[model samples]
Target: MSRVQCPRCLRPKTHCLCPLIPRLDSRTRILLLQHPSEVNHALNTARLAALGLNNAELIVGEVFDDLPKLLNCPGYQARLLFPAEDAQPLQAYSSAPDEQPLLLVVPDGTWRKARKLLHLNPLLAALPRVTLAAGAVSRYRLRKAPGPGALSTVEAIVQALQTLEAPTSFEPLLKPFEALIDGQIEAMGEEVFQRNHGEGKA
Candidate 1:
């Protein structure tokens, strides 16, 4: 089988239709601590989210040896955007007053991979967990969730930031995600039509 490069990003891209990623400045800083394995995935939205925000940083690794240093950075409050049983929703923490900007750290990977990162990295676990509201669909169609309401890293970030009353610039960042989803649907529809008409044959 021949691999087709994505017409947009020019990468051997998957059908992930997220649009031209936008870059916006936000008061809440976003730090996406992604697993190395997630970087190459065509559907990875963390990369797209990072492209949309000026204060966002996407770091790839299995461990964070410099966790303390990152936490100590000036004008930043570090919090992990993970949904734990005991964790509070992002809105609760977002309303808290602080002179510093909020640093939202999200782990991007499968359930097993994310769990491994959390387990192997004690520093990450030390941070307070921020959860989102229950009952949301995942934007990623390629991966199956271990359970319901498991959101992709990008969706989690957007939801969390919205709770914080993040700047209006964030709206632009969401456009790419919409574009991507729409594009994927269109592509899939075309494929289905072609197949039904026997035009997809070699």
Candidate 2:
């Protein structure tokens, strides 16, 4: 049987999440440097993030040759969002090379894949890096984070933007993400899904 795809989200019909996606605009433009492996992942949140944001750009590749061109074209302060131990907290920085609009370049993939992106892209690594505040956790129930403080790509982007952009909550941006989780739970049956996730009393 040929697998039918959802036109909006480009996912299989049984797991189509386009209906839950919301169009959002942000001054801090989002640049998702997604690993080729994740572009089509069934449960990917990075795709949702890119589609939901008005100023977001999704670039798929492991090692990119156009990093200089993309960054120069944006004319914004491009910053890398990752959890590397050396990444500085956004709050700690009070300045930049100039007062240009911010462009958040996020690496979307597994921890290892994300690391490879940074390593392969020297320009990305050289850019300033920001990490989520301590204790931020992932509400992405569909996947297990690789380590403590790990969050889904979309969650990190929203939280980082919330912190830097001065919003009491950018949480509404995550409602569709939550709905995606809920849809999966509904399909898998709440009790069974919860049991597997070790949530509540089984």
Candidate 3:
């Protein structure tokens, strides 16, 4: 077997191309609170999103030890990116005045882990929640969701940025994410095809 490492996430480097990632800049700042476990996983989209956006920050941890400082960033309005039964929709938060729209707080992890973060962090729960109305299919083929339209962190951010009418720079950043997912799907399909066809030397 070939010993390849995933370029983007730096895992065994196999089946991952996150390293060829592109950079992006946007008017709105994104703050991703990622779980430690998710950081080590090969399918982490938060890392890709952070790499694409210049104004985005990805912090790996279970708790926001520096919550006070983050909340104090000047001219920034912080809102949690989540789907709560009682939370306001993402469109509502995106429509807020741009003059005070600097920060967006997102929890990066699986549904279970993300929920745990919300339950454990009362401060995060107190923050306003933003739920997205995304129409695009998820790019993460390696990961499964409880339901349809559950997107990777990067896709969710892209949808949110579009809704918020963020700068044009944000659109291009989504390209690499699309590329990475397509690459993975293509590679996997080739492997399956070859296996089924018995093209390899017997």
Candidate 4:
């Protein structure tokens, strides 16, 4: 029989990560546009990110028909968190006292899937884009990263939040993610993990 799953975190009941998931508030609102294909991913970090942040929303789809309303959130300026040739570095952005906080729109999927999202939603692609600083590595040891400086969805959100809201650590948001990684490693056995991902187990 299939193991029972937690209704919230969607993990098998025995490995449920609900307790480690944090409920934190942030000034910048986050809107995650996740591809449908990623919903059942073992980690599903985008869902974790949405659950942990008070001011966040996750919408799963390829074409978002309500882009106008979603992008026009009051008191917030929407910025797409995606890389581009002319992407603005998030570190250089700061809200003035009179300015609105950011509504960071993140796409959750593999690079190809994410790009497909942009292709399907022209307005989403047209938004001003922002990117994280280079050299930050991902802690997702189970999967080979597509490239250097790659990060999981939750990790990217944490780094983006930390940069946008400096001096206020968003580290607690990573508790569930770390637990998930540890659990996966343990399940796969140390020898197998060491053989595959031990080189950069950060």
Best by TM-score: 4
Query: By lDDT, is 3 or 4 better?
Result: 4
Give lDDT for model 4. 0.93
Candidate 2 segments exceeding 4 Å error:
92-98, 200-202
lDDT winner, 1 or 4: 4
Decoy 1 TM-score against native = 0.76
- Descending-TM-score candidate ranking: 4, 2, 3, 1
**How do the residues 1-202 of candidate 3 rate in per-residue lDDT, one tens digit apiece?**
7577665465455545454566666667899989888976656778878877788888888777687788677977888888778766665234445557648898998888988887877888788777788466775555445577788888888888877763443566566666665765676797664565333423
lDDT ranking from best candidate downward: 4, 2, 3, 1
Q: Which parts of model 1 are misplaced by more than 4 Å?
A: 1-19, 92-99, 141-145, 166-169, 185-202
Estimate TM-scores for all models: 0.76, 0.86, 0.78, 0.95
**What does candidate 1's lDDT look like per residue over 1-202, in tens digits?**
8577665443456643334666566788888888999977756778878867788888889988887777675787788888788787766334456656678888899878888889989988878887887887765553455577787777777777777764443556566666666665576796664564333343
Q: Mark the regions of model 3 whose C-alpha exceeds 4 Å error after superposition.
A: 1-20, 92-98, 166-169, 191-202
Off by over 4 Å in 4: 92-95, 200-202
- Score residue 101 of candidate 4 by CA lDDT: 84
